[model samples]
Target: MPSAQDIASKLAYITGQLTAGGTNAQMKAWYDEYKKLNVELKEAKAMQKKNPKDPNDLQDPKDLNDPKDPKAT
Candidate 1:
C-alpha cells in the first residue's frame, strides 16, 4: 500500500494534468486514477488513525500496567 503522502502526490499530479487539458480518453483515465487515489488516501488515513505509530499511544487492557488488573503489582 502506498503511503498517504505518496497518494496525495499522485492525486496532485492528476489534478494538474486534468487542469492542463487533454484528449477525452486521456482525461478519463487520469480522472479514474484520481478517484482511485482519493479512495486509497481515505483508507490510509483511517488505518493510520486506527493504528498509531507511537508506542505510547498503544494500550493493552490485560497488561500489568492496568490498575484494575488483579495481577498488577
Candidate 2:
C-alpha cells in the first residue's frame, strides 16, 4: 500500500518523464504502475472512510493533463 507521499512522488516522476519525452517503453512502465497504484489508493480510501489521516487525503487528486504542475514544466 503506497502512502500519499509515495504516490505523489511517483506521479511527479512520471509527469517529469512525460514532459521530457521519455521513451515509449519507459512511459508504458510508468503508466502501468500509476494505474495500478491509483486503483489501490481508491480502494483503500473507500475502506477507510473514517480516517482523517488517510494517505490519499494529504494530496490533491493529480491532474495529469494540468500544465501548471511543476513536473509538467
Candidate 3:
C-alpha cells in the first residue's frame, strides 16, 4: 500500500494530465487511476489517524481528571 503522500502526489499528477486533455481512452485510464489513488489516499489517512506513530499521542478514553473517576481524588 502506498503512503498517503505518495498517493496524493500521484493524484496531483493525474489531475494535471486530466486537465491537459487527451484521447477518450487515455482520459478514461487517467481518471480511473485518479479515482483509485484518491481512495487509497483516504484509506491511508484514516489508517494513519487510527494508528499514530507516537504512543504519547493517544488520549485515554476515560479522563483521569474527571470528578467521577475514583482516582481523580
TM-score of model number 3 = 0.70
Question: What would the C-alpha RMSD of candidate 3 be, to one decimal place?
Answer: 9.3
lDDT of 3 by residue, 18-72 (tens): 9999999999999999998888999988987888663333345543367776877
TM-score of each: 0.70, 0.48, 0.70
Residue pairs in clash, model 2: none
RMSD of 1: 9.8
Error of 1 at 49 (Å): 0.8
lDDT for each residue of candidate 2 in 4-67, tens digit (9 for 90 to 100)? 5566577677667767777799888877877776776676656556675554454445533367
* lDDT head-to-head 2 vs 3, winner: 3
Candidate 2 stretches greater than 4 Å from native: 44-49, 53-73
The Cα error of candidate 2 at residue 39, in Å, is 2.4
lDDT sort, best first: 3, 1, 2
lDDT of 3 at 20: 100
Off by over 4 Å in 3: 54-73
lDDT of 2: 0.66
Model 2, clash count? 0
Evaluate candidate 2 by giving its C-alpha RMSD to the native, one decimal. 11.8
